[model samples]
Target: MNIALSNTSDKPIYQQLFERISAQILKGELENGYCLPPIRQAAQELSISVITVKKAWEELERCGLIHTITGKGCFVAELSSDRKLQIRDEMISKQMLLDTSYYKSFGLTLDDVIAMLKKVY
Candidate 1:
């Protein structure tokens, strides 16, 4: 697993970690049953606190992306293709809901937003 942490980012370290890992899992970059490193080891390697990594791992578990097994480590959950697509859409729609609210605040219509998105995208 690969992760890049940004201290300068507005998001907290744990949140960043959670997002990166979840993205990888959803995209099938981290296949089902792939074992994640222990929290302490990950913390040492990433030079972050154990609590941060733990929090991120907890979030991953909460989201059903990873499962922890006693004596073994955390492993990516087996997800169907349809489930992956459902999760991808859910995540994107959530972000879009927030973005849509922001756009509405600026008095931008859907067409205007789509146009801007097209340009940037």
Candidate 2:
């Protein structure tokens, strides 16, 4: 599992971790049963607190993207293609809602947003 952490980001470290891992799982980049490093090890490697990595792992488990087995480790959850698509859409929809609200606050209409998105995308 690969992740990049940004100290300057507005989001908390754990949130950044959770989002990146979720995206990878949803994209099938992390296959089912993929083992995740222990929280302490991940924290040491990332130079972050173990608590941060633990929180992110907990979030992933809460989202049904991973499962933890006592004495073993955490692993990516097996999901059908349709389920993956569903989760991906749900995640994107949540982010889009926030983005749309931000654009609306800037007085950007749907067309303006779409045009900008087209260019950037």
Clashes of each: 0, 0
lDDT per residue, candidate 2, 1-121, as tens digits? 7899999999999999999999999988999999999999999999999999999999999889999999999999999989889888988999899989999999999999999999999
lDDT of 2: 0.94
lDDT of 1 by residue, 10-116 (tens): 88999999989999999999999999999999999999999999999999998888999999999999999898889888888987998899999999999999899
Off by over 4 Å in 2: none
What TM-score would each prediction reach against the true structure?
0.92, 0.96
Off by over 4 Å in 1: none
Report lDDT per candidate. 0.94, 0.94
- Count backbone overlaps in model 2: 0
Clashing pairs in 2: none
